[model samples]
Target: MTSPTVSVKRVSECFVKPQHDHSQDAKQPIYLTPFDLPFLNLNYSQKGLLFAKPPPSENQHFSITTFLNNLRNSLSATLTHFYPLAARLATRKQQNPPSYVIYIDPENSPGVKFIHATVDVSVSDILTSTYVPSVVHSFFDLNGAICHDGHTLPLLSIQVTELTDGIFIGGSVNHVLADGTSFWLFMSSWSQIFKSNVNENACFVSRTPIFKRWVLEQHDPITSLPFSYPDEFIERYERPQHLKERFFHFTTASVSKLKTKANTECNTEKISSLQAVSALLWRCVTRARHQPLNSETICKLVVSNRGRANPPMSEDYFGNPIGSVSATTTVEELMAHGLGCAALRIHEAVRSHDDKAVKTQVARWYRNPVVYKMSGLLPPNITHIGSSPRFDMYGCEFGLGKAVAARSGMMNKGDGKVTMYPGREGGGSMDVEVCLLPEYMMDLECDEEFISALIEE
Candidate 1:
């Protein structure tokens, strides 16, 4: 199928000043948790496009131009609450001891970039297609350079694309500043502002971001830290390879069946829907790779620490509040035991994450100071699963209506990476975007068990 054409109409920068004074404490360094160091030298960014239906009338109140203006205005106001997002990352080298911090120099740093574009296609043209369109990348302005010195870049960029029948709101945010959950918080807040009307009086966002540096600093003092990009990590990231991204839909009914089967096989252990679905995907991909039977494989589940913190951190604490939990097993054991065993392993791994474990992990990283090396650890046998099925990606309404479709650009089609989102159909379904080599993807498509488990309608 031919890809849609997207033309950039205009490009401009948007600087949003905070509503309140943060100058007194703006220079203090916001210490990076052990979780944030690995991403320090990486230029990883996430891109998501939210599609909204066309307005009901052509009145000035509902015109496309007015909508864009409202979005920009609300975004500027939203930044007031999420002030750190409008700030830049910097390291103080001239100090007796250099300190890493986020600099909110309103006079210096250019705020987030906002792009205006038009697409020569309809929302249905891209959504109804079998695979995601390549033109989707045009909706985002990704960071192309690899940062080795922790050089600062725009923390966020937003592109609003006008489609033939709808509007596409795309956002690109640096991963070093926030993870998937925090990123969505910003997006959700922007939508709330728009929904509440971009009037001057309605400037406050529903959720206020907590930028207290003391929360993490008290646990681990801010100091000069060395950043390293291992050769293996560099090679893996820079390797030349072509990848395909495909979305597989699993309906609520189908998921229930899988959960039932998985639990029955594991003596009715009451495995969650996420664990069951993850296990199914793990099994399918492992079989597709056709790895040696005795080879050990692992699934790294990205777990959020919002509620796992002692007394629990605020829902809007922000930053990268995440850690990984792994479920490891041999290829032989996984294939022989089927879904139940894999599901049980996943359940155990997820259940292991708690307040004590999160604190202990942070303390360990604080003492060592060396970021964990993830490259070449398990070679092609590791599948890193990020994001969650619980996030309300579809509920992001910008006064028009709920989003009809959403897609992520940071989800690269690497060897073994997968991201899950809540399906648009809205009955507790899931949309699993799988990224793998061409051959393995083909094998997964042909797997009878995997095909049978999907909702065919």
Candidate 2:
């Protein structure tokens, strides 16, 4: 039987520009490093935070209008710091290979698009499910608009979906402007501003955006991709596999055990918590696929390149300071070898991507660049992990209270795409959000050997 249908209606829409004017940088092209250009053709990174609606008796004065007013005003203030986000990407057609660059003309540029919508669903309907309802996807805007579309699209768009008993705040950020780290940083700062205003006496120290693009001396102030576009569709053509998604919650204790077990088997060097979790999902997903023992399987782990840069860039430095390392092995080797063996492979690959290696990767990209399409990046059934549990998603407290749940929109999503978030209870706990083929997800949910481990759900 079909699950209950869900629908949403927009209550209002408006544009919120930065509280301060930044027209001085209007025609100046904002720098887009080699690391940032790759995301130009990709869709915005979409994520949402759900909060429980306060009861009427708790605050009779509370109204959606007032709440949104505060939110919009706070956002305007926050944009003053993250001024780059308020800008749009403009193409330089005169160049031999037309290029895209971020340009901000506050006087004429459209501000961040803000929409208020209401969903016909309950708080329980969203928080209680192991598998998120697909309809929740509508809670966000800019569904198919790629970062390249930022030439005309809002660099950042926000949608607040009001549920009967909760509120889901979703945001779509142009990937060319920020990575997961920068995205969450913006969210956390927005929350702080909102809370500070709600309680006037509260310390309202505004966070600063570390817009240090000079770290990459090789990157030019006027950026352009190594390759020209318009060939080999930039958009993704997903597989025919019936896709399904599920959130796998691992407790701090369970994560510890996974780490301990991985370290014991791969005893040469201690594996990290991230490595263990990635290994577990890699092994289980491959098992569920039930492929031939000889079939090759690969796991691409997305890692931040900031720490690997020369002089080691600041952790708070904004923009896409990201890189990836791939670990490969045969299905037979992966399945027969167990989690420890798989983890060791991942650990070794990660360990080898030192500062020099990261520089080399960036340099190579400078010589030869490929406009990436989400679907074709990896072979079938191969795991590509993005995002991380380390991001402080729960720390975002926007007067409404702590978020009850965290979710990603239907952007950059396809089979084998996994994003990790810190569990609401924190304390080293991890939440692995997995997307896979329906049959594979079913088998994974039932895989006794895999589920036997210490997993919360």
Candidate 3:
């Protein structure tokens, strides 16, 4: 396939603050919790959506200027209710080490970065590509930023890119402020305000967000990171060795089949769709890698601590309530026993990661205060899962049109790093975004069993 002429250039950029009077409590500082601290080592969470515009006859009020004005106005109105997003972070030296604290100050004011750009490429050019084009990465702001860098950068930045016949909306959020759940919540609220066009008095999100931050029992509020310097976390930003990122769409029926097969093979445990798909992927990737039978392989899944914690945080609690669980075994044990065995291992790890387990991990983090180095931490033969298929990704409509596809930023990239989203067609469907080494991705593509299980998109 020969390449075509493609170019991307920034058109405009500005800061958007809350529409209401935010000067009342402009200097309030919200301390991060144990649930949020480890994310210091990670990059800002960047996610985007692409939407097609209806014909001019269909939407007589539409224009390049009108579209930008609508989005800018709606985002400002939406920020009134979520004012924390417009704030910034500043470093606080606690004891000898440095700590981060988020606050909206009268001196610095409050605002979120909004960037508008145009690309000559069409939407089809993006969706039809074998892997996510590296250009999709530029559709967002804060290219290689770490969450800890929020002190010098905007706490949140949104980029709205105009495509040839469509539009791309991408955003980057400091993971310390909002996890995947909260990010979508903000997006949906912004969309709702844009569509309603009604009197906005704040409060439009489906669920009311609980802004009160969580603190581990007996932990100090102004806790400092164990690192000697903030740059220690930045060192982890080495580009993940993987060069290929593929989006695998698993139809609703195919997911059901995978789930059924896993449960049938393992009568003792009724595995879920996630566990089932993970099992299939783990086996396929391990087999494709052709690692020695005695080699060790690990499958890690990031679970929401919002529900699994001791008392369980509210679904509306708007901070990072995340924990992880991993299944470790030799390649021989995984492949010889089949999908059922692999799934059960994952299921059991997820099931056993109860409140006690969650607390234990938090406690350990508090003790050592070690942040995850992106390219290091996990083993080479590993599958690390993030995000979820339950998020209302497609519901984010901004009046111009609903979304047709989704893409993420340069963050969280590496071999076997996967993010899951509900399919655009709905009905319990799932889309798995996989990043892998070129050769391994080729092998996985050629794996007949893996390819046969997928639904042709």
Candidate 4:
């Protein structure tokens, strides 16, 4: 089969003034800041490169104007359906981060060229044995992937295949621009606009712009002590390559099964599926590493507060949700005691860093950018749960059929990295994809029983 050629050209008149609402009083509202702006807002980035495969047809080169028009319509339409905050982001610009999506010319290139443009697939009997790629991995890749650029365009790009079917689309977004949710909204909106269905009152509406420094100045009790970082942790942060990563997954049913088994064995009230799976994962990761852990051996879990906060931010908020770290241990003592005890520890860790703590943390960062900077420089061993949007919005209608594969790659962090998200087909359960070091995987592979637990029953 002839490879598909994907080329993008920037339309000169592509610029449009961002839409905004002027009804609110002009008096500076809450001193505008990045926090005020949706989180997916772009930041100037280091340069990188992008290349796509040649089109499958002989004369199927996509025109710059046509592609841009199509993209605008798709962006507009996508924003209308899933996230209304996109319009606000389009209008919100500070020192004007040099962030602009560009056109790539994948005229006649290597086979790898098209691979870069295409999505990934799941490795199940449904996809592999049948020679059909499942859309599950594609959504994961689109939502979690990042781009590296080093040319004139200089901006990361996330391309939806069409103006209507948001699935079967693939693109790389820059991490610095926004967190996962924020990035999704921007991409979705871009697709909606390309489709010419932009919502008039989307959530991307820019509130008064507030800089980070000013936000810190407004708060009383702003002088909180800096989050102390241990010297060893600081060293590890400086060496990105030194860290190890592994990817593993568990289905919703498998998790429930374990939860039931653990609950029955412990004779306790029901434990959350999340808690049960977390304890299992924590233990597995630690054992895989052949490391002896203790209560202080922490595993940080990232959960979105989209639907869990007191005054839940609008789905259109487009910024980091107000939340904090839920942590636990893989100590032999804890694991040996009983599943319920371990579940309780994990539960408390999550509850401990509630909304108030999260809000306070965000505020402190504004007041002390240095502290946030340091923490980011050295993030904990994070295990993101129920945060992967792979299957949640898989039926995205950017005009294309469902995606072929979805897998995320930007989470290059921590000793044992894992992200839990919904499985494809909303398959009545969730799937956790683990990315860790090869040595760790080898260790895990050595234990057949441990490895078997990860497979969906």
TM-score top scorer? 3
* Tens-digit lDDT track of model 1 for 145-231: 332222455677787877777777877776656888888888888888878876668877778877653244365355335432234
Candidate 3 lDDT by residue in tens digits, 191-308: 9888877355643656667777666788776556755556665555766645689999999999988888888898854799999999889888888889999999999998888888
Task: For residues 110-152, write the lDDT of model 4, one tens digit per residue.
Answer: 1110111223221232233321122322322223222212122
Q: How close is candidate 3 to the true structure, as a TM-score?
A: 0.94
TM-score of each: 0.88, 0.93, 0.94, 0.59
lDDT of 3: 0.81
lDDT of 2 by residue, 1-457 (tens): 1155767899999998877676565434566677787776688899889998887787676788889999998888787777777778765433555543443333445789999999778888876777878768889999878887887889899999988888999999998788899899899888888877833344243556677573345565555553344443367444344568788888998888888888898775579989998999899888888988988998999999888777787777778888889899899899888778989999989989888898787777767765677667656759999999999998887878788989998778777888999989988898888888788889999987568765554
lDDT, candidates in the order shown: 0.71, 0.80, 0.81, 0.41
Candidate 2 matches the true fold with a TM-score of 0.93
Error of 2 at 237 (Å): 3.9
- Residue pairs with colliding backbones in model 1 are none
Once fitted onto the true fold, the runs of candidate 1 whose alpha carbons sit more than 4 angstroms away are 4-28, 52-62, 94-109, 145-150, 213-218, 227-236, 371-378, 410-413
**Candidate 4: misplaced stretches above 4 Å?**
1-69, 76-156, 159-177, 186-249, 265-270, 293-295, 305-309, 359-386, 389-391
Give stretches of model 2 more than 4 Å off. 1-4, 23-27, 95-108, 198-206, 214-221, 226-233, 236-241, 455-457
Error of 4 at 136 (Å): 15
